[model samples]
Target chain A: MVLVAIILSACAPGTPDEDSWRVDALRSIGDVSSSVSSVQLALQHHDRLFGPYLQTVAVQAEDAAGTASTKLSAVQPPEPYQGRSDTVTSALDDAESLLTDARIAVVRRDSAAYADLVRRLKRTGDRLSRIEDRIRALPDDRSRP
Target chain B: MKKLLNVALGVLTAIGGFVDIGDLVTNAQVGARFGLSLAWVTLLGVVGIIVFAEMSGRIAAVSGRATFDLVRERLGPAMGMANLLGSMGVTLLTYVAEIGGVALAFQLICGVDYLLLFPFVGALVWLVLWRAKFSVIENLFGLLGLALIVFVVALLKLGPDWSQLGHSAVSFQPPKPEAWSTWAYYAVALFGAAMTPYEVFFFSSGGVEEKWGVKDIGVMRTNVLLGFPLGGVLSVAIAACTYVVFNPLSASVDTLGQVGLPVAIALGKIGLAIALLGFVAATFGAACETGLSTGYSIAQYFGWQWGKFVRTDVAARFHLVLLLSTVIALGVLATGIDPVQVTEASVVFSALALPLTYFPILVVANDRDYMGEHVNGRVLNVLAMFFMVVLTVVALAAIPLMIWTRMGA
Candidate 1:
């Protein structure tokens, strides 16, 4: 009885006409939700398209390095390229793999695994972010321009 | 002299209570969405918090027991346990959300992803809980969180139309095209954010922690009366900033970065940086509060000694629960779930669970056995009863509204 009364009471009248603002706010919310959904989709694509290839590269890189110095030197490039190309490729591959795992988690709606994969992907993203930062920090003469 | 000190304590608790992650998001979200139409909710919440907080504080002062402690004694174990479970679950979820919030704020400022910051933020919270003196940890973050005043400065910089804002707040019709469900959902969300279970648990627990006796009743009263409303002002400032900035852009705040954007626009990077610091402090402070309250409720329920006043070795189980709660929160954040979404859900869940925690406190406050001479007078009872009715209604409507609005779309 009291519960019914409570429910009815909460049905109080709301704010008056501001239809335009309401549509605008709802649309804005929809756009943000769509953006988030899109990001999730992109992450899925990264995993499916690039994940296995990266794992193969990682294995090959491991095989190429019979010794510590050889492994380091093989991964390293010339003066112009430095060690960045290999690092960038490897990192991107790792990110794509993580994204793939994240996509699987998302499919399963596993909040825990989805969170973990997102964390892993974020780390990969951070590595990329740092590479960009370092590249930007370099003198203009070193740039393509 | 003691009277003055009590007033100061009230102010500090109110400050501590005002700026949880829910307030950070809800105030900003509503401000962005409806301008100040919902600003009145914050005021209403302040009044609600004050009324209930005073009652709980007075109950503690007179009975020499915190809110939950009396809840068990008065309501008996079964009902109290139900309240305990509901309140504790909501509080724990809130703790997880706040820890995530702090990490997200760090990500915003440092250009690091929030997950990377999760372990470190978790460790920092644990370190504070483990080592820092209770009063010091409480005062440090509670006081430092005042940096959130940057929001107020940003609001001033934005220069909103005050009369228009006042009209929106005073005019209570559901704005056009907004499904009544969505409006009510956000309304319930705002209400839940304002009267989160942790606030009462923390407030009542703080009263007990500070050793409030019957003589301390006046001090407790003043704290509830003044501090909460002041905190509401900060919430208003956040919402108003969003109203002025995001409303024009029609930007919905889905991230901590967006929440801080108005500050960034108004005061530039420096303001954004400080506001982020405030966000970190406020959320981290709340994390600690919820974490501690998790252990406090359990310990108090079973007749175990609890609180920061005791040493780690003496309160082994209490410390253990606190440690585990922080670990779980860290784990949740590491999963990379969006903290903002978690905070939204936490506030909604808190809204649904409101009556469980609050009704008991109201009942206890009016009990002659518990409150004695300090029992709620006629006026306080009337006000408390009214808000109780309000809270119960919001709780019931919260879930259906969420589903209907698709979590407010």
Candidate 2:
């Protein structure tokens, strides 16, 4: 419930412009965040069956992040938000790359790698959230009817 | 004194063996979504299975015929074939799910894909079925399966508000945003998991496999009466822990990792280690039972030489079916389908197959030719008939409710 609200309130501008790249970018960021956090929670408790559970979500995160990155790659941002959109897409790609690394670390029980990946995951998540915040601050896309 | 010890061990094994992948996963899922509101279904399932297990056990002890044998004798070949096919199909589906469950549990420990473990799990199960003495298999896994009690220990460690959880248990009202259909759907799933037909098939066939006679009825009754209700407590414990952790977040449990999270959150590392052990033992133990039950139902229906009492060569057809079924289970699980989803479908389908599997037990237990003086007495008759109605409703509504809820979303 908390996660859902975080994603929705972060992604929605009063109404998004049909062409608003910010909305698409923010939504992708939210998706990556949700998937990363789920994997992160499983990892923090990494010494147990959560590893197997991580194995389950690891595959899902891989698929979801792939789609999110592909969608973000297609987005051409609006005038003021173009730079923010580029950063968001780059952060998303990094996050996706890290999730794959985390799955391998989790499977291999590479605690050092798991530790490093988790730190990177947090930085990536924070980056996504900050971009979402900036997108949330933008005024409603006035072009939508 | 020796007989008393034997009875005690039997009951303990039953208690330990009762929680399988279906119970572990379904109970945790329901608890997260509905809190204690649906706990009654697990309890109801316990009492229901006990009532019928005693009857089936009685039939096996008195007549020395396992379930499908009498099912064929009483229900006739044609209708009995329908029963056999329905029950065996779901039982095979459940068999595949149990193999996947064991693989899932192993994955938790090693951080590997469950599919990678399927062949070894299936091969180990078949090897055990082929060579292990029946009593050794029954007692070993069932006893190890008791590691599931970690859920109860974790629940106490979590120290939830009992009065609030108790109120939800009493009210039977689902939390907001959950509709009645979804609740009813899980209720059926719980029912199917608890009273799953294979447990009985394994129980009665196990009675015959161990050569239970009138001499063993006392032991069998003691196990069902005392063991099953205690097993129900472990099922509730899984739900209680999940409710404490995931309910507030409105999280629906989808992964085995989520199921063990509450345990880790409560007791941390050591608790999770034990819970993972529980996961492996419960699922592996059930894999053996369901795998055997698959072979038991088919062999008995055809009147083939069966039971571990005979040499493998003497029971060649039975052993062959067991081999083929293991391969089939391996094939199904190797397809990359989720075992958790398979468990949900198996239990719901088990609900659909319940009456077919059980109605003959009720009939055979009552028949003078089969049971003689061992037939159900008056009070037991009243209770059995009442549950028949309840199980009938559960069976009729299971499919529609599953479809309406889209497998509980």
Candidate 3:
């Protein structure tokens, strides 16, 4: 019963206070960052990777990024933290878009586009990582209920 | 020489069949996040499993009965029901995940979506369970799963700093950026993955299916003692492979493809192809085992005739349970659930189910009625008692840790 209650409360939608909002936002960022880095790694070894394996990895990355974007978007951030939430969500959007492009390149087996896609993915991934670090460094002003 | 060959085969199969989808995903995820810091959990879990499995095998050998059959007789129907519910529940969940895992493996190989392949994977697993002989199902997939040895080869090819890996293995502390709760959560997951209930259920039941008596105890002991540690080595090799490749990048393994990526990085296309084969065999093998385990637990509890040693027609209800389980598992997967998520849940719940499944074995093993002169000795009793405490602690901690860590978010 306690487990069910905790899970139910977690699923209930409410505007999280600043600290929890930051934690949720950073989790989304971390997920997208991991997905983006997966694509970068897969693309770097595309020649050695099987075509189907490459496609599967790329598609999973895109799905993960898409899910992170949707999850972060669903979070009703408290008024003061709305800007930070939007920034993280926007970064996720970019990551999702890059992942989609990477997936297409992988499906088409376009070696020529691989280099640029890897570069873009790494840059976006690095940006997401930096965002996570910044959020981690932020002071937890648990002022709002 | 024939007897020697039989022992050799049993050991080889045990080593190959040791890893299932849970071990594959959890070990890779831990290695990626914590390096070798959690390696001790896998070792601890392996020893725990070996202790119980040997006792269960001994029970089967001496009593001419499987674990669940003896569980009900020794512990009474009420406690047997409790064990059945916990162990069978996780085994069924694991059954679904292993079928889906096979589809995922096929998807990686053929570029088809796993959803498209689920029905076929489900049917194929059912067909094998229904048609294959006990030893054939055990040996074919187990030997094929030896392809996972590529992980050992992959780790060597990666040329990791041995001293650094040894240091992490001994660290016992979580690495930077990991909290103790998160480390503890993964530790429980690793233990759960290493010592899932189905393995023992399958082992004890398989002994019955093969019609083992006292003479076969030597072969069983050889397999458990020699085979399981080697299998543990393979588990650590998988972690070390991912640790060498993904740890430096601070990435996590969230997909099946990522679990096999380290092999591609180290040994190129052929190695990747071999790893994919390993995935298919390991998951498919476990799918068969867990599927049978579900039937074994229920039929044995209900006093229905069970075991592949009997004709399918003779053990009608047991076969029916296997068929229904496959259809239900497929039904669950048809709703488009993520197999990896199912795999994760199965391991955690497997931890929760550990004591329920294991305590009965310890009790029955000590009962002189079942083991005339073969009751657990003082030394073995001390060891098993220690593990019982550990299992109880792990079982109690599993859900709370899962909740607190938000499933190791």
Model 3 pairs in collision = none
Worst 10 residues of 3 chain B by lDDT: B400-409
| Candidates in descending lDDT order | 3, 2, 1
Q: What is the C-alpha lDDT profile of model 1 across B1-409, one tens digit per residue?
A: 8668758865875675579899999888777767777777778888888888777777777777877777888899998899999899899899999888887776655555567888998899888888887777667788768778898898888777888778878866555434567667788889899988888777778778778787777766777777777788889888888777666544455556556667766776567668877887899888888888898888887778788877889999888888998888888877867678899989988988888988998888778876677777898788888998888888888877775565776
True contacts kept of each: 0.00, 0.24, 0.67
**Ten-residue stretch with the least lDDT total in model 2 chain B:** B248-257
Clashes of each: 11, 0, 0
- Candidate 1 vs candidate 2: the lDDT winner is 2
Give the runs in model 1 whose Cα sits over 4 Å from its true position: A1-29, A32-145, B1-6
Across B100-138, the per-residue lDDT of candidate 3 in tens digits comes to 999999999998999999999999999999999998899
The runs of at least 3 residues in candidate 3 whose Cα sits more than 4 Å from the true structure, single-residue gaps closed, are A1-15, A140-145
User: What is model 2's interface RMSD?
Assistant: 8.9
Order the numbered candidates by TM-score, best leading. Answer: 3, 2, 1
Comparing 1 and 2 by DockQ, which wins?
2
Task: Give Cα distance to truth, residue A104, candidate 3, Å.
Answer: 0.8
Query: Candidate 3's interface RMSD, please?
Result: 2.0
Positional deviation of residue A58's Cα in model 3 after best superposition, in angstroms: 0.5
Candidate 3: chain B TM-score against the reference chain B: 0.99
Model 3 achieves a DockQ score of 0.61
> Model 3, residue B13: displacement in angstroms?
0.8
